[model samples]
Target: MGQRTVIPFGPQHPVLPEPVHLDLIIEDEKVIEAIPQLGFVHRGLEKLVQKKDYTAFVAVTERICGICSFGHSLGYSQTIEVLMSIEVPRRAEFLRVIWHELSRVHSHLLWLGLLADGFGYENLFMQCWRLRERVLDIFEATTGGRVILSACNVGGVNQDIFDEDLRGIVRVLDGMRGEFGELSKTFFRDRSVQNRLGGVGYLSKEEAQDLCIVGPFARASGVEEDIRSYGYGGYSALASFEPITSKRGDGYARCEVRAREVLQSMDIIAELVDKIPDTPLMTSVKGAPGADSIAVSRLEQPRGECFYYAKGNGTKYLERFRIRTPTSQNIAGMTKTLQGCDLADVPLNVLTIDPCISCTER
Candidate 1:
């Protein structure tokens, strides 16, 4: 073997969205081993539960990640609802699902843009973000905030959209769908994109499962596990919903999974709007959770399955709160994908997993 050399991969990079450092060991221009260093921007958001109380903490959870902000808020609220035995109303559930799916579409669009930029496809990158702005506009129109939406609460959603607004949302999605097709064609058929993504960063199904990878990473590897299938937030109403998967388990497979998921999200939003009941947007949640009660909730976020745990001691405050983001769980898989790849492709493999360092460190 050639003499090994160590090189730091991140904490700051042109393509990465958040700060995550990697100590890469390379020999003759190929990575021999890869190690990750986290906590560069650890915000300790979970610890704020002790000071904010259960009802007030929903706002804090929404700030954990901008791309998946609504998902985090929904997860935290659902956990509290479970602990307090509050039954969320049917209409609220449907509305929550609508917002959650919109968030997913926004996140995937952002990822697709980043992926295009990673391989120097700057035109495609610009096209993807340009389309993504329509999704953000829908968010701002409904929730009054494009990124950090404070729309979910412990019992239900904080706001409601009229039937007219829902119809407008569908129109926006229709326009987006048309524009997205033109952009995605470049991702699927362009020679340059295929050359950079196809057959690169391969991960076997067994390796993905062993690493406990979640979200699109696991699905792209054919794991067939999507937490949305468990039926939280009106997902159960869509009986035919199935997790998207590809057996190839490579960078191309990952990109395909996310691309298809964006289309699927549009379908889901339309279905929810059609079936949404005309009832109150939120239910009253009273009293604190029972003493020593513990609740755990899982939801399929844009990145992957996000797990939330909340414990109560019958006081005004929560005893403990914990979050396990998908990026944190996929670090092992990241290391596996890094080995034996060219040094230049390191960022491509890393971005393919769609790492959200803020979510991981929070």
Candidate 2:
């Protein structure tokens, strides 16, 4: 029997962008167990709902994670809308979904680039980020901020994208489709990429359900669970929605699902702008939420299912606000996947779940 050793993986590492620290217990070259350490970057932002009024906290939620900025803001606003019974206009709802899906596209692209980098595919990494830049350009042109777009509010959006600009966004995504297709081919068919990732970290469908995994991570494990499938909000307006799933349950499957999701999100954005109605962007918000009123909302973030909760005290600020990010939910599944894997494959296996420590610990 090989001697076991304990190796601390990160709060800082070259491979992972987030400050996720893991104590990997390994025997020889195989990992036997992994213990995660979190809360290093906890900022106590959730408690700020007390200081920041209900409406003002939209910006605060937007800052939860740069990649999922629009999703966080949208989820928080949707929660407040339910609490206050705010009927967002149809046009606003469509716009919300458009921006939210765009966030998903860019986020997946960012993850794809990181995955490529993790595999030492430098050129592929640059190409992925270059395409991601186009999505950011769309955000910059519309919301004026590439990353932390402060566009969402409780009732609706702060900015209304005109039909002309919406068409422009579609055109841009359309143009990127061909290039993205080529990238997908490389990710799927490249011998090196396949050899590096294929069958590396396996999570069976039953295991995924047992762990209650969310988003593409679960989808990769063949669990057909997507918040969008329920058709909430503007998603109801979509022609059809089904989560992109792969039954392989490996690192390759994870990459494949995310790569495919970028394409799916682009199509969703196109549908949204096509059906977007011309109406008022923002609804007038009046009166505070009912005393002790609580509302919860769920969103399919880039990582997985994000949960938002808000409790109102019939005052300007919410009595309490909480967000359960997907990464936190998937952390257990991540550790479970680490057992019996090669020590060297740890980073790529961890990246497959796409951890966002900022959102998870906030």
TM-score per model over all chains: 0.99, 0.99
| Runs in model 2 lying further than 4 Å from the true structure | none
| Candidate 1 lDDT, 1-362, residue by residue in tens | 78999999888988787888999999999999999999998989888988998888888999898889999999999999888889898889998999999999999999999999999999988999988899899888888898998999989888999999998898899888988998889899998899999877899999999999999999999999999888886897885788999998999999999999999999999988888888777789888888999999998999999898999999989999999999999878988999999999999999999998889999
Best by lDDT: 2
* Residue-level lDDT for 145 in candidate 1: 94
Candidate 1 local accuracy as lDDT?
Answer: 0.91
For each candidate, the alpha-carbon lDDT, in order, equals 0.91, 0.92
